[model samples]
Target: MTTQTYLVSGMSCGHCETAVRSELGAVPGVQQVEVSAATGRLTVTTDGSVDDATVIAAVDEAGYQAQRG
Candidate 1:
């Protein structure tokens, strides 16, 4: 498994966390997703290699921004 952490922006509530989690969870190879709106942090666990672009795009789809940390 691979674990990655990202710094996300514009997350201010539980709903934001949910959106980020749902989007990241949809990514191929993603096994788990953890997000904290308070901290604006996102962590993803995957069964295989997952690219930063994919994760960033997922966050964008969730109506937020993210960058690998």
Candidate 2:
């Protein structure tokens, strides 16, 4: 599996974190997702190379900004 971290912005509460998690968790090959509002960090585990654009799109869909860390 591959694990990666992202820096996400605009997550101000648990709901925001949940939304981001839900979006990322639904991506194909994603096995785990952890979003931290306190530090604007997102850690994801997947079975293969996940497209960076796809991850960005997921965060965008959740109403947040994200970039690879």
Candidate 3:
């Protein structure tokens, strides 16, 4: 498995985490999504290499911004 962590902004609660997770979880090859609003971090585990742009796009769709850290 491959894991990537991104720094996400504008997340302040569980709802925010859920939104991010839901969006990221939909991405192909993603096996798991773990997000923390308090830490402003989003971690994704995938079976293979997942494009950074795609990950960021998913975060954007969740109403937040993210960049690999």
Per-candidate local distance difference test: 0.92, 0.92, 0.93
Quote the lDDT for 62 in model 3.
94
Model 1 per-residue lDDT tens digits across residues 1-69: 999999999999999999999988888899999999989889999986888899999999999999998
lDDT of 3 at 24: 88
Ranking by lDDT: 3, 2, 1
- Runs with alpha carbons beyond 4 Å of true place in candidate 1: none
N/CA/C clash count, model 1: 0
How displaced is residue 46 in candidate 3, in Å? 0.6
- Kindly give the number of clashing pairs for every candidate: 0, 0, 0
In candidate 3, stretches whose alpha carbon ends up further than 4 angstroms from where it belongs are: none
What C-alpha lDDT does candidate 3 achieve relative to the native structure?
A: 0.93
Best candidate according to lDDT: 3
Query: Could you estimate the TM-score for every candidate?
Result: 0.95, 0.95, 0.95
RMSD of each: 0.7, 0.8, 0.7
| Ten residues in sequence with the least summed lDDT for candidate 2 | 45-54
